[model samples]
Structure formats: structure tokens, C-alpha cells
Target: MGSGHDTRVAVVVVTWNSAGVIEGLLRSVQGSRLDGSVRLIVVDNASSDSTVQVVRELMPDAEVLQAGRNAGYAAGMNAGMAAAGDCDSYLLLNPDIRLGPTTIQSMLEELRESGAGIVVPRLVDEFGALRLSLRREPTVLRAWGEALLGGRRAGRFPPLGEVETRAEAYDRRTEADWATGAAMLISRECLARVGAWDETYFLYSEETDFALRARDAGFALRYTPEAVAVHHEGESHESPALFSLLSRNRVKLFRSRHGAARTALFWSGVFLGELIRAARPTRRAAAWALLGNVRGVARPSS
Candidate 1:
């Protein structure tokens, strides 16, 4: 956020009742870019709390777009990007992220040099813990791999879960199918070429879909160590909700890429896995979340 030569950044953040984290995120961005003037756009996804009010107070100059209804994640982003038309680039960030120095600049540079459509930073948490936001799109096999290796056995083996800490996990710069939308920088050209986040996905997996499309459109997805940010990881508060969304969205992504038979088989395997997990509390609960989405379950909040 430091350098400036007339390239305006449309820092779009989508929030819903995020009164607790919004202020700090804005301040962090403000802190990151003391050297330039940034056009901040905060999209309020029909928050029930004082999230909108807090944003107004903390970042008065920010153009707050009120989506009176609780338009899901992709919708909020699409709205913000449409409003931010023709900017140098659009940064689709989580409301709880605090970017490191020159993170955006580094991402923009990589986007230019690598001919990439999207660029994502090394995402870390407040406690200096890393979250795996950058990833290979979740396949049913990957999901099963996660269910077996992650969640329960996370403390036992740490390496199985460093999917997002690219800077730490990989030694050199590389191309991915897509980077996480959180703390991601997309070139304006890529935006026009690949288009917006698919509205079909409410939360999870949309970026992955967009990334795959960008790749097919001949744009590489880059993960740069230089562009780093402290991601608060606030999007998934309830384990149940995240599980459901990720599971369901994974189905949609699979169907889009694969075929109906493969998709059906995937879900069938997931179903059996849930039955086997019935005796275990943590596994059973997580399994139920996966089931809820497969059964077309709707989040009461969504």
C-alpha cells in the first residue's frame, strides 16, 4: 500500500455482521498504505449487527455498498468489483486480514511479470500461525484425505496441512490452478477475460472455479512469497457451517469439471464414510455437516 503513481486500488471487503473485526482490518489496510490514497469499498451483506455503522465510523471515506439482503459471498464480491470498474486491480480480501508491507505491490508485480490472472499472498494468522488458504481445488479424494489426515490428526502431523503457506511449503515461485480469493489480487485484464466469481457458490470454492477458468483462458495462477498478509481466518466461525459449504461447493465444482457418474460416486463414498464415523463424536459431527450440504441443506443464517 506504500507506492503510488496514479494506480488506484479497489480494496473490496465483504462483511456480514462483522462489527468485531471490520475496524481492525480497515485500520490494518490504512496502516499498510500510509504512503498513498486508496479507494476502500466495504460491502455490507445485510448485517444484523452494527457492522455497517462501525465501518462508517472507522473508514468514513470508504464507499459502503449496502446489499440490503444477505447476498452471499460471491454476490457481494461481484457487486464490489462492478463498482470498482477499471481500477488497476481488485483485491478481494477478508475483513480480518492485516497485510504485510508491500504485499499488494509484490502481488501486482508478479501478476505483471508472470502473465498471471490471479496472485495470492502467504496467509498467516494473528497468532503467527499459518492458514492454508492457497490450495489445489478440493477433490473428493482430497476431501477424504483431509478427513483422514486433518481435523482429528492435525496435532499429530503438521506437514499434511501446510497447503496454504506457500512461502514456507515451497522453495520457489510456482503456478497453481487458483489461489484463495482471500487476500488475492487479480489483474484488471484477467477480470475482464475470466470474469467475476461465479454466483453459484455462496462461499467456498468459487475462487477455485474462477482459477480453473483462468488457467483454461491461458493465465497462470501465481503464489508469491513476497506478497504476505496476516489473515485472521474469521470466515469460518462454526465448524459445521464451513463443512457444509465446503462439501456442497466441492460437489458443484466436481460436477462442473467431471461428470455426473463421478459426482454421484463421490457423494456415495462420503455418505458411507459418515455412517462409519457415526460412533465418533468429532468425526460424526463433521460428517453430519457434509451430509447437510449434500442433502441441499440451507444455512438458517444464509
Candidate 2:
């Protein structure tokens, strides 16, 4: 139902205790000469810091929404999107991400050209390192591959510019299985058809679920090297208990959707992977966050 090019846009950023990085993110965004039609939406997930205040002061024009408490990522995003109403497209962003000036403009162009449901830009770090924002669906095989072979290793490679990397067309966006939620451009039609993020997931795996559902609904997830953003990947896998909790949550999602057979396979792989890899310093926090995911989906905790 959209015409050729839609200058009207809404950018949704979800934050949680990300004050340190968010300041830079907002600053970078404010500096960008994104189309004048672009509207910025910052949803603070009840950060205890001055994140909310800083955002209000720095980007006063940016539509600010507070979750009242530390709500999960999905819920926060949904609230922002609802407030944004219908736009030609929506840019889903993270608080720590740094967006290129033309990123939003370029993504909008691609949306018109490709007609895909979603478009995600190239992700890089402050050091200018590449991050594979495109990826295969989080299946038991993919999860094990991550736990065993390391998932984000693709970041070490060059940008996957309009090319196929892994197995035939795997996450290539010509036919991608999923795109990272960091800074994605989604179509209004798809948003109406598929609706907003599922409230089930607390933090992780929600993007995967959304992508899979979109695919099922006859929409393709795309990756464009043209549009780019910088995202700081956070790792809190220091505690063994946290690691175990994350392990449990992974099973929780898989089992809930795919059934016991697939979940069993994934757990089997993870159990073996634990022996193969060392734990991180914040593993306990990571594990607890994982448990929180289980609690999240189970109760739809906002």
C-alpha cells in the first residue's frame, strides 16, 4: 500500500541500563542528517541512571517513552512502536548503536526496491570491525554451531555485501533466514500483518522468533551492506549458574515451539559444548538473564 519512496520514518531504540553508551548513540544520531521526516523514538526500560534524562535533554525532539520498570526488550519496543503509529517503515535500533548518516535513507530506498518485509544494515564496531547482522534461524544446529564453533566469528570477515556466505543462500537476504534486530528497517505492511514483537521473549531470541514468523508469513528478511551501524555486543556469561540458566532458557524456547525432540538435541549439544568452552567472568549474570527469559515467556512479564 506504500508508494515509491516514503520519507516519513520512525526510529525506535530500546534501552536498559545503557546510559554510558546511549549518550554516544544519541549524539551520533543527532549529528546524522537523516531525512527531515525521520522521527526518533527512545524507549527507556527503566534505567536507574540518567539515561532517560540525558535522552530528553540531548534529543528533546526524540519521542521518549519510559517503561516505568526494567521491562523486557520486546515489550519496550512494542510500546514505542505503538506510540509511533504507522510509518512507511520503522528502524529498530539498540541504545549503543551508532548509525551512519545515510543508513536510514539507504534502507528506505532498499525497502522500495526489494519490497522485502525487513531490511537490516551492516553492523560494525567502534574499531570499525564488521559484524554479521545477518544470520540463519536459531535452530538446534545453529545454536550448537554457535556454542561450539562460535557464532559471531563472521564479524572478523568483510561485509557480506549482496552475496551468499554459508550454506546455499543462508541468511544472504536474497533469501535470509533472519536479520539482527540491532538496526533493522521493517515495512509497515509487514508490521500490520505480522504485528509487533512477541512479548514472550525477555531479551534474546525474540528477533529470531519474529524473523521465522515473518518468513512463514511470506516475507523475506534482508541484509544490506549499504546501510551500516555500530553495535557494542554485551557479554555477561561470567557465572556458571548464569550459563546454566541461559542453557535452560534456550531449551525453554526450543521446546515450547519445536517440541521435546528438537529441544533434547539442542540440550545434548550444549551439554557437550560446556566441556569444550570456558565460561566468561559474568557467567552468573548471563545465566540469571537466561532464567529471566524463561520466566519472561512463561508469564509474559512486562
Q: TM-scores for all candidates?
A: 0.83, 0.80
Tell how far residue 124 is off in model 1, in angstroms: 0.8
Model 1 lDDT, residue 170, Cα: 41
Candidate 1: which pairs clash? 132-164
Off by over 4 Å in 2: 1-6, 34-36, 143-173, 237-246, 279-302
Expressed as tens digits, the lDDT of each residue in 141-235 for candidate 1 is 64454455553342233343324443445445777666667788888888899987888788887888888988888877898877778876553
lDDT of 1 at 270: 54
Residue 163 C-alpha lDDT in model 2 = 17
Candidate 2: tens digits of C-alpha lDDT, residues 1-302: 12233366888899887878888887777666644476789888888888888888888888889888878888988888888875777888888888877777777777888989988887777887776556654466655665555545432222312112343223233547776678878888888888888776677667777877888898888777777788887542444554564466556556556655666665565544554453443444444445354433433222
Q: What TM-score does prediction 1 earn?
A: 0.83
How many steric clashes does model 2 contain? 10
Best by lDDT: 1
Which residue pairs clash within candidate 2? 237-282, 237-283, 238-280, 238-281, 238-282, 238-283, 239-282, 239-283, 239-284, 242-287
lDDT of 1: 0.72
